[model samples]
Target: MALFAVLSGLSACGLPRSGPTKGEIRAGSVEEQGDTFIVPVTAQVARATAMVPPLGFTNGFLGAGVIGSDVIRPGDVLGLTIWENVDNGLLAGPGMNSTALQEMQVDGDGFIFVPYAGRIQAAGNTPEALRRIITEKLDAQTPDPQVTVARIAGDGATVSVMGGVGGQGVYPIERPTRTLSAMLAKAGGVIIEPEIAQIVVTRGHHTGRVWLKDLYSNPQFDVALRPGDVILVEKDQRNFTAIGATGAQNRVHFETQELSAIEAIAQVGGLSTNAADPTGVFVLRDEDPATANTVLGRTDLIGPQRVAYVLDLTEPSGLFNARDFMIRDGDTVYVTEAPYTRWQKLLGALTGAAGSANSLSKAAGN
Candidate 1:
């Protein structure tokens, strides 16, 4: 009877649990105390929470028209060559009929000085336009002067490319690289996996982002590049935590832009088949007031509410619901241990105690 009592007490003792049981979770959901609300994962809940915000270029970034690449700007270097009709023209050398001028840089004030042509506004004019202007300026002294302007190396109309790209530097916006996609290619493309790569374009005060893959599929996202634009290519940072009775416990990053609950579970190696309770898979997130109201079908909730969305895999529509339910960044996906798992642990403990008593009794008999 003494040995029986000891084993009974051991069985009555609290057993280790992976997480809160389904009933305990439901009981603790009190809106008055600001406790986590237990929202069952229904089709309605899935649809309501599916309204995830999309990432793409804004109107300001998309609506801007492409600028002409050949249009000269300040800081552009020009090489001018002039052929005069007269033997002794204003710019002609003693024995030469033509003159060559190299390294003529456009000043900060958008003016470039030529010996015979005087200071000319070189900025905002194409090379051809500048050539015509210079010819007209020198025509009186040089007699129908023929002028040619060639664009040399310049700092005008450039973009800074950094982060996860093959080459990171300041790239000029030329004819073949006037758009975002073209600029990315000129920078040696994204070094990371295209599916997980994110491209961010910052112009002035406004910024926009899109998936690297989306740039090709969506024409609107392939926005025209602007001067002084900063482009960054990097991996997606969005992730969720997998805990409790899952096969693995870690923060798993999103493999794509949109991640569903089913895919999130799979990424963590799925739930433990032996210990996981099929009826108690929960996704924990802090729901904003607007989203919380939509999920709970109430309006009085204010601020960010702690919400625990429960998914029962044993139900008929369980798989479908999980597939439809989107897993957001910073969410915690937890699976409760099966009820039998705790019972098994308790039974094992009691059996070990009983076996020890029997062994002690046998030793005394000897």
Candidate 2:
């Protein structure tokens, strides 16, 4: 009779007499218990970090433009035009003509020496500014000398594009009103499944990322390219691991441009029939052992919580919209089965018969 009472009490407590230790529950089981106890599904409460659709750019979004606002440099040719002035003893007819025309190339020092005008700074000055400087110098020698400067060779600005593009090269900035899209267009756009948001632009020592969607949707997020700017578009890494009881028992590779938790599960062919607990889905982000130990010691716990996230998919509604949650670059998702999941169907049939037999005995006693 005492042994029977002990058996009944053990069954009521829902714990087996002897089984796995607390350390052997696996990280997945702990998450399941937390969800079941803290946030009951019957309560209709939403998970703290449920996945949602990404919000694209907003506001007065403008396109990125080319860089053309810098001073002229060496290796640039200048076309100089001196007007034919005859009234002030300047004639343009023959070798002895007073109107002498010449094209001057700036030396390494950015100085251009004219016939009558001594040394004049030509580098780091706009064409218009250079023309004004020459006019002032020639005015001292030849009265009312007219001068015009024209750029015949190189512009001092360029931008680079690489990765996931048809052609990766440095593009010369031809216009001042160039935008990010315009630059990509110049590079023939990105390849299929390109990580648009991962585009990196480096200028000098500063680096920044420009989201392609943001550049198109948000008017205020336009990233302007400058001279010596380098734009790198690299292919995003797509790989994940799946453990626990599932239909397949191996890691899978998803070639999706952007993968989510629900989509990742589908790639592995869904959960196993008899071994899967729909609500026991978790993501384990393996961290450095040193870091894990530090975090565990702070909380005075035996082991650290390396489990990044625990997602409950038991509810039909939750499973239906699981695709909205985004997964990280390299994450391990585990699917565990509930303890009752494998026994509930069998226990139901025996429980009914046992209850009927007990009721009949009580009625007979009455």
**Which number leads on TM-score?**
1
lDDT tens string, model 2, 71-165? 55664556677753544444344543244344456677887776667788887888789888988877766667777776543333466788867
Error of 1 at 166 (Å): 3.5
Score each candidate by Cα lDDT.
Answer: 0.87, 0.58
Error of 2 at 143 (Å): 21
- TM for candidate 1 is 0.79
Model 2, which residues run further than 4 Å from truth?
Answer: 1-23, 26-47, 50-70, 74-108, 111-122, 125-156, 194-197, 244-259, 272-279, 286-305, 308-312, 320-324, 337-366
> Which pairs, if any, clash in model 2?
60-219, 61-218, 61-219, 63-179, 64-178, 64-179, 64-180, 65-178, 65-179, 66-178
- lDDT of each residue in 92-186, candidate 1, tens digit only: 77978898999788899899999877999999998899999998888777677888998765677778999998899987777788899998998
RMSD of 2: 13.7
